[model samples]
Target chain A: MPAEHAGPDGPGTARGFVHHACLYGSDEEFLAMAVPFVHAGLAAGEPVLAATTPANIELLRAALGDDAHALDTAETAYFGRRPVERVSAFLRYHDRRARPGGRLRMIAEPVWSGRSARQTAEWKRMESGLNLLLAGLPLWMICPYDTRTVPPDVAEAACATHPARLDGERVTPCAAYRDPAHYTASVPPPDLPPPPSAALAPPTADLPAVRRFARARGAAAGLTGERLALAVLAVHEAADHLLTADGAHVTLSAWEEPGALVYDLWRPGPLGAPVPALAGYAPPGAARGGEDGLWLARRLSESLDVRSRDDGTRITLRVAGPGDAEAL
Target chain B: MAHTDGARHRGGTSGTGGTAGTVHVGDLRPGDHACALYASDEERASILRGFLLGGLDAKHKILYLAGADGPRGPGELLEQCRFTGPPEVPAGQLEVLGPAELSPRQGELDPAALLGSLRAAVDRSRSEGYRALRITGDLCTALCDGRDVSRLLRYEALLAAEFGSGEALAVCQCDTRRCDPAALDAFASAHPRSVEVDPLIRTAELVVVRTFDPPGLRIEGVVDTASHRHLRDALQSVASVRGDVRLEMSRVEFLDLAGLRLLMTFARARAARHCTVELAGVPPHLLHVITLIGWDRTPGLRLGAAHAC
Candidate 1:
């Protein structure tokens, strides 16, 4: 038996095999991490039950390819407001096909805030249903948000009666609750494309070509240069891996993992000759003293950025800033 | 037969009762001819004129008219009600003067008055050669200003049995909404025929199901355990004799304990024959109730969900 993740015991402190699952991290990461367990289980002649929303089910099915024994609970979506019955029905369907050595794995992606009070009752019912399903079966539960958003009763019940091994942290999980730094460090950053190869002559003032390139490749490809540039800076500041295409660039200052072009396209530079200051001042990650300097760089993707008095601090990357950001 | 001496010397104009001759009370049945009661002399005179000139039945020649304590011997009563011929062909001629009974005491309810009214109705039924008589509020009012259900049913049974079995059906109306709670309670209490619909489900034998936007039964909160037992007994009784008689549960909201017990009994009774008892319009709450009690698992009791309209 494993000392489960909770209380003072940290997530990394596990003696037994720890299964760490992430939701919507990336198609590649998900396939690399989650798919092997499913295939291995199925190949072993043990039934593997996987539940995702209707849209995600298709993606999963596409990924699963030939091993599609999955049945649709109405296109992989439960029909009504009652999550318990829907999950119960899904489990029932799975039970019919379950082999002797099979185990149940259920993943639910709630559209609402998992931490909100409004969904407490519904969550409790869902927990109860999950517990019911857990009877006579080994179940693994994954919810990709903070559990603190759930009502205290629901959290307590989940902690006490629920037999599931829960994943995902909306607020924070108990195992990582005491250590804020390790918890914060665990949040993986988004993958960005590498800079274009072979530096060419600076653009002319017209810059229409650069604009078109940015518009076509960067903006249209869902990466505006501004945000991408901001993210690149943030990634450099954090000293974490920046996965991209155009080959892996091991800068002295930053950690960069290449081959992200599969998902991102490069936007050409703006049509203007570089100014002296701009050309002279290199990025912190690509500067003279690189890796160690980047290592010394603070994590830019944090909740607080402002410094008191003379204290200098960096702000973490958030889609919204300050007053506009949604409450966690 | 025992009151012959008392009856003969009680009133004036006794020997000369009528020109058509007096009729003995013994000839009355549930369905006879017409028996009427007049509140005033003017009404009596007009009624007499209408009957005599308007063609009356010779059999229904006996008349009882009481106006301001005036003379009303059988002879004058006969003149007041001269027979012409039979009323129009196939006309329902049986009538009863249920409200004509007089008593010296005011506001005192007399059960005998109702009996007498029923007796008059029976006499009128006999005169008309009809075996069926309709008794409405007039007969009910004559029975001391309130419904006398037992006496009414007893009279009905007497009239029906004499003429032929199942010849009479008394249509008793009980509007719970308009009726006083005490009156309704009293009526419901005394009358075995009165049914109070199960509120959870709007099914009942004799209880009136009210129509609302969301239709359901408004039950009288009190549970009639005896009635339930009676219903069960009735169901069980029929189960053995007629296996084909379907126990209809159309208006029932929810089965009470007794109803459930009876249903189980019936199911067991018919289990040998493999006959099924069907239940319809069972509400979800009621179904839950039954399920909680484990009654739903009983064999031979098949119930279908109500169709949503």
Candidate 2:
């Protein structure tokens, strides 16, 4: 099968690699794309960095097999018995590795939900410290589960420093390609509750309710073992592409609507109407077909750079290109 | 938890209703309380017999003393009369109670605990049919916050309806060969009542030991070792009459000196005008000091009995 649209340069070629090498679609889809890059960097004697969650870390480790290097805060805390230091330390370690097969990987997990005050304070300090310390690093912040756990302040700070592509929560470094592994599903396990404090005193009657709430929250966070396993499987899918003979490239189908506009005061979407949807797309089952897809994508990109009519909501577009020493 | 008797002072959140009035040890009148500040053995003994024996009944009362250990000097007389150290007694027995042990920090007594103790003490005293309650310690004792003596005394006043007001006494020895002008000044300031004995001269009912002589003030022996009952009788006699006669006390000396000067000062100032002045139970030493100093000719003194040798 031709797989819907063949995309701009087709698949399986590394020509526009770095320019559009970002992975998008879903958390699973991004994992599918990231795994191979991780392996390729390890094999090519370059290091990889990932900032993700504990549940996602478990999935990544399982899919990467024993040869892949893995580090999540919880596992590191449990095994190393020392607090995880600087996020840059992982990259520094990879750079200094004596062996050729060693590659450094790092993930910053945001798991504070219903935690103690002391724990919350400690987590905030650690996150703030790490973000401030590694502000300039090229490490990919893989917020695979969700970004809500990371406080809004941290998200804004990180996004301000780096180029961020947010697609209904599937954020990445830039425009990304959707690999086949983007869509995977899993079944959840039965919920449980927290334990009693003093066993000798009395049996805890409300343990079941507490467990139920915990499970509900954990499920919403995409932290169940089953969901994590599915994400791990997606990583394998990404690894398959990275391990292919040449760079197993993928292409993103043009969004049938315009690129998502983050609420800037712009009007006239080509035919001149406020972008019908923020992602700037025609509703599904609309009359527009093949040309509509390309038109929408281009319009979205162009609208992103358009200057708005109002002052507060004004958005100006700038055009810059390769080999141009000067920028617009 | 402190209640105020004066309309000028606002009552505490948990204050009980109370009013202001002069408290007589035997009157047991409503809203009448005593403020007992004992600085000397005689004062302590006087307070012990007066309050404990239903002497101050017109007022709700409290006892204030210094040093909670086995009473020192005048305190020993009180110790003999069932006054307990802070440790032996329960908190209920004392009103506005604070001890050196209750607070670890200096000048910071717990107001809550102290107030609670006061209320409890008042309730206990009422149930026991006692006219007044007593809290033994200096106003300068450490309380909840670092409050000054004056403030703490006011606080005690506000909390308890009647508070005993007294002073700590300073002792001096004087004669012609070695006259202490400061000591004489202190004695003059005391303005002790002049009493002429055949040989001994009593001053403010206290025993006097003269170490020096002032030009006009006679020196004599005084009697300060009078029993609690005898002291009580002396105070009652003066208190029974309505007059402005003042009692001088600077020339007096005692084994316990706390509040002695303050008592004399209070008695003189509180007395009404145009009343008969009678000096009673002057310690023999104070009488001797008075004669030696030649103060018998001084005004405002009446001659009284000398102790039988």
Candidate 3:
């Protein structure tokens, strides 16, 4: 196992929002960096929450023995669920365990190699967005990446999202880390093929017909159960954004990718100003002021990519199906 | 078999029968499955008395399922309702039983068995030459006994499907004070018609008023993180049972993002079912806020004519 290294303040004295990335080439290397980080928190009496793969959790449990019982663990299966929900769950857990005037420690690996392309994109967005969401909170989070398992591009993206990286027992600042707001703002829309020519015409007076068209296409493409339901909601919320505006027109198309249901909505307008990172995390019932539809669409779908051009704004929403992992 | 309140009696009976028809306690028709939500013992007894008396006057066989609490027993309830005759128990016009008597097995609530028993009772009432079988019961005891609520809802749905338009009537009573809000909401949705004799009024924080007339829900008070779960459960219950829902939000003082999200989810689900959701009586400022969010243009959702903003 890796040994715990002393920060500037000495060993086990880190505070505030400390973001770290653990780059390891093997399970032993990952556990080496992870176990000591968790043990340091336990020694300092900070609440520790671990949200890693089930295999890693068992490894830590075996290493910690009875002490592992005290650590808060998240369901590993949840990483593949809606990114917003996972964020909400983490916030809730943090709120519950965080002591007044005390800091909380968390180890979260929200993205893995097997995740669908859409899931990976959403997880990356969530990683960047968390910088704003957890600002001013007394929390420290370390996201681990398995160099042997995670793709090179993903590992590179992690370096850009986290302020620091941990290699074995050595910790150093990541020169590549970009401010979350700037990084999120610069994320280009997903690259997808053009919609089939048979796409539904622009929605006008008949909004219900448009929703029905999307639903029929989604269902026929083998999107069933929760995936289908999520696709329908995402399409409706996005279409609603355009359908409600005067003279606004929207063209809808849906098709099945290898492991996802994709809907493309095109309207003849520029995507409005950049949506704030915190908008997605706003509590329900709080006055949204504006961006209500966009906020809702983002939260409902697995991934939402908006490409704005002088000619039009194209909104692409991807919902991961049961076969999402299989396609990877 | 004689009552002096001719006008009220006539009004009650006129609304009975048919899936689309409205039926209150005083106007219940056979084969109707009604849910009555009460906030107090007095309200519970009043609704029960009206329902039972209406059945007796119509010459139907009456069955009362009482909990241990009260109006203590059926005799007390009859006295409260001002029945002029000696106890009609020996005369066989009415029967009072405990909730367990209807259970197919001890300590368990089986929907299929319960339905079978109800069907048997209906048949027995017809063979005994009664006009119809009218049953009323307090579900608090069963729920307290750990009866599965989903099973109970399935039973209610089964009852509605089997006898909703026929000559037998069942009124399941739930005391709001004893039941959890989520359970109460579920019970309300399971039945075809629900009546709240005692309106649910809480300290100004939040109050969800479920109305049967026109079949809609009125939300008054703040819809924030503190109360969004309650709002979601309440709206979901109504949405699960009915296609067209009228939401009266004019009285709503404040609605946060969470509330708006719940509303949007509800509207989307209803739209998928091809149902219309009408938002009525929205204050102008709130209307402005809703329009700002572009929710007014959501599919299957309509802003009522009363919305000025």
Candidate 4:
């Protein structure tokens, strides 16, 4: 499970593109693996970029001395805005920096110790997506995961996303790495509990009433300030779609669970099969446009889950509180 | 027809309601008419009590026209509403009468006479130190008695016009179980505002309808993975129309990843066509979502002010 062959060895002359996860216990261990990679890339005359914590960047800068200026360093927080945005930025950087017919080198530690659960989930997806995103590009990406800092689940996810691992410079293929498409499809967020509040059934013509209902309930549930406004707005968006449709009726409910405020909108009738536009998964040619609402919802909320049955479709929106800071 | 001046307030008081979801009957200005369709006796009584109590609080002249064969008379129904203050009926400020009293002649209907009676009531209320005349009538008796639907509709329209003059407010009650859908629609269309006592039933799948005038599509229902393609197709079709496309997203309840992508794709496509895509009634959360994904920065995309309601 820790390591196992990714593919056949290429010709000695052609540059190889390796996606390896570096699992380390201490700062010294991270340096031990990272410095050599940077040295090797420099020796190979390839452009090198390091996207990690500022402290780590500083450490590497000091260690590399004059050679540090030769490598590009970007704060990982810049890329942490959202997984898709980060990938787009990386692709742009790679395209601009890569030398034609030459190799590109990148060391990315995108996930940190204190990310929200939603953030972690997106990061994992980003990792899996990179397999396809960087397939033909002459890039070798080293995704570093601190075994001491990241949760066991995230470590496991890293193993599944990368096709190889570097433990103290011993690069070996990862048997656990599943195909990107398969991995992305298999890992879904857990189902949330039903909203505790009773559903507010408002007629299509009475959308204002439903909005008022949601705002009041959201306020009563202690969602104040921007959080309260966001919760109410989220509920309004969901209720608006249901009430305005040609449906008979729709019910909206909101409740707070431990560290998150949740809203559930239930509308009767089948929604057919899952549509690609709403999947939020980056499709082929996705760089152009699509899944705007899904992306917005996911980015705004801590988590969003949609369940559709033959009789009805229920959408649950959850916003993480300060207390629910365990990585997504 | 004599009240053409009242048309100025036609759309003004059409959708106004009190805060906290309460229908403050007294706060309704003249030319304001509301429909209260009830499914059961309890709901009817609750609505009537709220309207009467609000009128009483505002010192308006209250008139309750009860059905002829109902078990409880207007007086009994008023008592059941549990008024907080002393009874105002005997002092002449509140009047509870049967539909027969309002009829031009015994067991007969006269639309013109009824209009004259309503006008007379308004004049008397203003002159007798009342703020306004608030009327609640149980139209079920008239409809059940085989009264002409067109005549009833004409009377309702005249009443609306009369109220439009800013002299009175009317709450016409119809028994949903007794009235057919067509008859109900006819009555509802005559009034500016309508309220149904029964809870709304939930529907499956989101419904998208293309609107004319400003040219937009109104979406309702959950826009998740299962329904995003339909939404994309709808938007693509709408995009084929020239000029700007307005997306009325206020009614959409749940927009998942796929839904957002479709919106972005449509917006981008429209931008490519040199057409702007405007979004109206976007909830605060969606605005936040839009901001988060930086979709608000998409070219040729304009987001209208987020409506609180």
Candidate 4 per-residue C-alpha lDDT over B1-309 given as tens digits, one digit per residue, 9 for 90 to 100? 011111111112222122113133434555568777666565565566667666777788887766665324546766656555535553677776666666747765566777787778778888998988888777544753453488778778788767877668888888767886667767766666764221111225465655443566766555644566678777765677778989877655555544666787788888898999888877665676676555677777899877564
* lDDT top scorer: 3
TM-scores vs. true structure, each candidate? 0.31, 0.20, 0.51, 0.46
After best superposition, candidate 4 residue B137: deviation in angstroms? 47
For model 1, residues B110-164, the per-residue Cα lDDT tens digits are 4455445555665766566654443322232222225435543454344334434
What tens digits encode model 4's per-residue C-alpha lDDT throughout A1-328?
Answer: 4443222221112555568898888889889877877777877788889999898898888887677989998899886466656665577677679887888778898855788775677578668878776676778888989888889999999889998887756677777999886786566545454644544555333444555666676666655554655555555545544444454455666677788767676776664333221244332244633343344444456666655546776667776654544532
User: Cα miss at B251, model 3 (Å)?
Assistant: 22
Between prediction 3 and prediction 4, the one with superior DockQ is 4
Candidate 2 per-residue C-alpha lDDT over B1-309 given as tens digits, one digit per residue, 9 for 90 to 100: 011111211111110012122222332323323333223343334334444334233333444333233333433434544544412332333233335533435444554445555556556666766555544343232321222334344444444432222211111111212223343233222212111111112223332211111101222212222322334344444454344333433322221111222233324433334343334434443344334223343333543554322
Q: What is the alpha-carbon RMSD of candidate 1 to the true structure? A: 30.6
C-alpha local distance difference test of each model = 0.34, 0.31, 0.65, 0.65
Q: Which stretches of candidate 4 lie over 4 Å from their true place?
A: A1-18, A26-28, A39-48, A81-104, A112-126, A129-139, A151-157, A168-170, A180-188, A195-252, A265-271, A274-290, A305-315, A320-328, B1-291, B295-309
Per-candidate iRMS values, in order, are: 43.1, 45.6, 16.9, 13.3
| Chain B TM-score, all predictions listed | 0.30, 0.33, 0.53, 0.53
Pitting candidate 1 against candidate 2, the one with the higher TM-score is 1
CA shift of B25, model 2, Å: 3.7
After superposition, the stretches of candidate 3 with alpha carbons farther than 4 Å from their true spots are A1-16, A26-32, A75-82, A116-118, A168-170, A185-189, A205-210, A216-230, A241-249, A256-260, A275-296, A320-328, B1-20, B23-309
Q: List, residue by residue over A76-140, the lDDT tens digit for candidate 3.
A: 56742666666666666676798877777788876566776756766776777777766656777
Candidate number with the higher lDDT (2 or 3): 3
Model 1 lDDT, residue A135, Cα: 38
